[model samples]
Target chain A: MKTTLIFLVIFCTSIANAQTLEVGLRVQKTQEMYWENGVSAQFSFAKFKPEQFFLGLDYVTSRLGTAYQSNAIKQDSYLLSGSWLFNKNKPYHIVTRFNMGYFYSDLEEDMFAAIPNTSFLVSPEVGLKYNFKKMPISLNLGVGFYIITAKEGYSPGTLQPLYYHLDLYYSILKTRKK
Target chain B: MKKISFLFIYILVTISFSCSGPTITDDLLDGEVVFDPSLYNPEQFLVSAKYPIPTPADLNKHIILAVHGYTATTFEWQEFQDWSVTPSYRISQVLLGGHGRDYNAFKNSTWEDWRSSITSEYEKLIALGYTRISLVGSSTGGTLLLELVNSGYFNNHLHPKNIFLVDPIVVPSNKLQTLVGIIGPMIVYVETDQTAAENNYWYRFRPYETINELNNVMSIVRKGLENGMTLPSGTYLKVFHSLHDPVASTTSSVLIYKGLKTSSGSKIEVQLIYSDIHVFTRLNLRTKVTLLQKNNQLDVFNQIANKLN
Candidate 1:
């Protein structure tokens, strides 16, 4: 994992020297009230340029309470994403991102035994982020829809109904290069 | 160049913002029905006997036992009442053990316990004077039914007149057994619209508590697989599988079709539906099209009813 992270860091840095890259730790409080704190590093290949875009990755894990009678549940999700900044001319840039990733969790037996529980989710998402020029931070607001398929030993012929998620993230390093 | 960039940004923003249409509010229920988890007996996992009273007073009609996939109660079939408008057949939704009422019942249960619960339901239906009985198992229930049929237990109990499986899991023991052994027991959390926190459900039963029972269940299911056991001849078996279901994969249905098809005649028919979701019942039009194109449960049941007559 360390080696991979290093390789990614070097690869992202080599994209464009004129770009401003920010590597920092982020903590996200999901709608579920569980805190997903992780290290997320982002590299903007063409900051302030017309044809500018950014690539980012985030790994988050959290344990939250279930509506069911069980005590607590744990989930590990990895996100790989790329976003295109459409309007760099304005102080507030409109950025749209597409994320492709997977999530794994170990559900309680009572829950798994009862419903056709899906352990993994494979889906894509699109979101919008608004970067403010006055502050060194950006506020990201986005929504995602995912369909989870059941795995083996799980209830088949059952659908994990389409679920929607609304997220808010505060960027730690949103700065323009000199 | 600036003008071109501005146009590109305007188009992208328009497309992104316009992608999602206004949320539909028609399906919203007028009143909220607060589900009290404590009212029902946890042991009686099936639906209340009063809600879905079996149709047809004649006990001689072919009995069809329907089991819902995980995390769901017999209430899942409440929507099917309109679709199953036939009188010659009776459908009983079997609730697996450790579901419906109490969430903790899963702590003491194994896969065998669930199978036993289903078998007992079958026995109850048979004892009620139904001569011809068909098993229609969905999701995990489908796995249980397949394992039971493969075990040769049902052969003596009345010879399953037919078996209808929807997105069954025929090969769970091989793929998930090892993971359970290592993990001991894990739980997954599901988020609800009303709840602030996600609900946690166990992924596997505790090893020390139900290890022996699980091993026994695995061994029995495995033996049936190794012996090349197939459903008895004259026993009509139909499978309705979803091509895009995330939980029960299309491969699972294919395996069941291969394992349970008898050589005597065309006793097995497999229908693969291509859809955007897993279970088809909850989906809207496009998803339902995928489900119908693959296999219609009502159609399968009617065909079996005709043959029996």
Candidate 2:
């Protein structure tokens, strides 16, 4: 376990060398859903397209406040996202994002292991972003819905589909000088 | 560019308000009566009412309190009363606090008021010295039952013999239902696309206030389920759900099973039937009833009857 942890950290730091990378924290407030808090890391591989396109990844958990602290239904989600920004030079940009992810929730009971409570999730989002000129920082606000594809009784009941989030990002690596 | 941006904002606001549907008249009693007025004339509907006295024979039989869903009246369980041929049990159909009247009554009533009706009847049965008592709730009724268990109401009061839930709305099957809290202000009331017969029993128009109340209580019970609840000692529970309930999600049963345990820490009982309708146990006055629907109702009825016997 110790060796695996060291290797995982080295791998994550190496990936930060991508042309443009932004690592951030995300706070999400769901509509009639639970409060989920998580960390976000995003990078743009488009040396040609520059800031217009980006690849993002996020891991969110409700365990911080509601699930692990209060309720037994602890949920962890890891999402991979692709995004498009309509304007390149403007400080403020209109953004659309598509995300795909895997979700797992544990009821903390041995008897419920038979229920299919985990699911694959797909979501589409729309948001606005502001990039600060002086400071290498950005903030984004987005709303999205999970297009739950699971049949009835196969998905977790607490995992509703609609949510809005705020992302505060610090620029780790700037877009390659063009 | 400014013109385009302004137009976009205007359209978004317009759509938000448009989705709320329509508003009900402010007058709380502005609707036609659906059930026989004579039934509540002397308050015979309420088991606590002095008009109807339970004889020694009535007290000997098991008492089952039947609760309906949101915006519904006692008529939701009227079919059960009509079809129950055996004298082994008696059905006390309860009209939720704000229900069975006009639209205004529901608009102003809170969830607590709606729950009071069930508690009142249960206390009445106990006061009359009845030992065998059970509860059957459809939709929101089931949510309230779960709330009762989570609050430890039974541990303090008389422990019920059994609790049966049919298509409870812990998690709604309709995705749009969750948005009611956000869209409620613009759409003061939601209109139901129901036939005249259905309207007579269920409120044709649902007030946003009541919808919020339902959401509030459902959220409480849902959190309880997530944390897991222990059934009151000596009480039994069984949840019956349709495979594809269009109103209440089938996941509701799954949550109950996962989150709730019997007094002895055993998993609660659950049964899933094959049907696509909401409240599958209420079979009266529905359009285009199918063989499967009838069978679904009988299946649950037999289960409850056997338990009573």
Candidate 3:
């Protein structure tokens, strides 16, 4: 996993012109399921579409949301996405993205070890993003649907297909000027 | 964007136009024409009714109450009763309230109403001096049993010796089941796609209100499991689920395993059958049956029988 993360980082940073690295929060809620909140980070390049394209990573868990100090199932998700922005000049732009990820829920007991609590995830998303030019903040909203290939009982029940998410990104490093 | 909007509107309009719910009819089991015999002649279906005044020999044998699922009647357990010819144990096929009646009754019933028959039969058995009692629930029936456990129903009553769940639906395989509240108005009721013979035993039309009721009981049970529950002292539980169940997901059993504990706090037993159908035990009216299916049914029946003995 570490090697894949390193490879992705290197590949994304070398894509066009390594410029800015934006980091902040991602809050996601699955339809009729869990509310998972976690961190999101994206890297931007100056050329080859400049701010229009991005490579990002997200890590979210129910531990920070519904399961906190409660008996709700504890689950975690990790995602890698490549996003494209439309109408790059506007403060608000349309966002289209594809994400590949993994999901796992803690059953918390060894006896339940045989139960399916993990899954592979693939999703396509579309939403809108609003950027505050003066501040280092951007608000992004997206609706995504996972294409679940595993049969019903073979996959985790909480890993539902549809989800809505809001991401708040802070510019940790500014991109190079065109 | 324009095309997507147009398509969404078109689909909504189409469904809105097609939303004429069913009315009572003789051909449909949801109508007032037919009813489960258990409602009238409980003497035949329920053991409690047959032996309201049990002899010493009757009290010594174990009595296992069999509860059926949503929209189902006592016929669901008719096979088990016929299969078990031994006098060591008896099967009480309890027909849920408002079930095997008419459409209006089913539509108007709540989850609590559906559970009344099980409790009523249990209480009757207890009152008759039957000390050794167990329970076996299938599909929604299993979920109802879970609710009973969480609600402390057995605390005051005689604790059951064992509880067996088959294809219990804590989580429905259909994801859209949770969205009944939103789409329920647009679609007043859901029609069943069952064989002619099957219609006599189960409700043909499912009202949106009853769907929500199912959702309610399922939600309650799921929450209770998450909060952790214990069986009554000396009581045990065993869950049987089809690995590829198309109605009740196997996750239901998984959650039950993770949440419920034996009276002694040990993990309950679970067996996952490699089958594609739900409630593998009920093969009486099925159009076709396979050898594997029969074996699966026999396997569970024997295990339950062994436990009861």
Candidate 4:
């Protein structure tokens, strides 16, 4: 996991120029999904169609909610995604995204080590993004399905297949001019 | 940026408020009794109260003790009790300890207390000389039945002729259910999204301590499944599950099939219904019902009835 993060950081930073970096807070709900709150960071390549398309990373968890605070269940989802913005100049753009990721759950019991703790995740989503004309923030709402491949009883029962999420983003450190 | 920050704050506030609210209730143990007299009154449900000695007619007939799931009461099995009109068999509704009473009573109950009810009922029937006995449990009740078998409780007592499980929840389908150990203390009780009508029977709020106890039993049973368990000699077991049970996953049935074995060293029987509800046998309180749903319940009922014959 450390190696993957280091690799992602190095790769995204190397192409800093001509890239649009945005950091945001994400709130999501799947079909019967518990309230999951998290941080999202995405860097869109400047040279690779500017803001029209981008590679992104997001981390969402249930740590901040009553679900986690009350010791009901805690979950974390780490996703790497590719997104496309049609008609980038429009204040409102159609966004299509595909995310590949990992899901981890802590059962808090030593006896459950043999039970499934992690799963490979893939999600395909479509939604609308509205960028304020004057402010540096963007708001996005989309729905996605996690194609969890784990077998029955091995995966978390709450992590069902379908979900919907809302993203609130802000422009962060700009890419250096080439 | 200020406007955006303000917007961000507004969005955060809105989303945070959108979280599902907690289920708070007056504890049942505050002043109320632990058991529901109306439900447990021998004049009403406990057939044993009416017939202390088996009528020659009741003698030797198959008697099934029906057990309900966690946070549930005898209502879970009431439909079956009502449906069984045949003279060949009868239903004994066993109320788990701390159930069918009040929130305080349920909140203070333990899993062992829950299992004790089943044991006591079984013992009573055994004492009455009911040699042909079977057990039918739904969800947690099913888990308790399996625990009894895994712990060899059946070996010391009279072996049940058959054990029927309906969506026994070894593996919960709700993803958050698994994390109770870590998230339980901070969120003391998990609230159910139940209607007022449903709340009349099931506990709308679940206490953390009771949840912990449930996890303990589930862990014990899950490990037993992993290690494998054998039915008591001469006992038969069959599991029935919904194809899409939202509460208890159908995979639980699969685990039971893989882990539990007959005394003859053969695989136990399992049937997967093509329905999509948990405890498909209970049709009341459901908002919608299809022909398939009714058929699913009848199929299991018929199967159990057939075994009795």
TM-score of each: 0.46, 0.82, 0.86, 0.62
Q: What shift in Å separates residue A6 of candidate 1 from its native position after superposition?
A: 32
**Backbone clash pairs in model 4 (N, Cα, C under 3 Å; residues 3+ apart or in different chains), count:** 18
Most accurate candidate by DockQ: 3
lDDT at B247 for candidate 2? Answer: 75
Stretches of candidate 2 exceeding 4 Å from the true structure: A1-17, A37-39, A61-66, A69-78, A85-94, A100-123, A128-139, A146-159, A168-170, B1-30, B33-44, B50-52
Q: Which ranges of candidate 1 are over 4 A from the true structure?
A: A1-178, B1-57, B171-178, B185-223, B263-267, B282-309
> Where does the lowest 10-residue lDDT sum fall in candidate 2 chain A?
A1-10
Best by lDDT: 3
Stretches of model 3 off by over 4 angstroms after superposition? A2-20, A63-75, A84-94, A104-118, A132-134, A149-154, B1-19, B23-25
Assess each model's interface with DockQ, reporting 2 decimals per model. Answer: 0.05, 0.27, 0.43, 0.08
Question: For model 4, how does the per-residue alpha-carbon lDDT over B238-261 read when each residue is reduced to its tens digit?
Answer: 998876677886656756776789
Using TM-score as the measure, what is the rank order of every candidate, best first? Answer: 3, 2, 4, 1
Question: What CA RMSD would you report for each candidate?
Answer: 17.4, 5.1, 3.7, 12.0
Q: Which structure is stronger by lDDT: 1 or 4?
A: 4
Deviation from native of the Cα of residue A50 in model 2, angstroms: 2.0
* Position B55, candidate 4: lDDT: 72
Evaluate model 3: give its TM-score: 0.86
lDDT of 2 by residue, A1-178 (tens): 3533553474377465567889999998667767788988777764446687877888788886466556445677778788999887999999999998777876565544554567887999999999999999999999999987665445666677899999999997875575
| Residue B292 in model 3: lDDT | 99
Name the 10 consecutive residues with the lowest summed lDDT in model 2 chain B.
Answer: B21-30
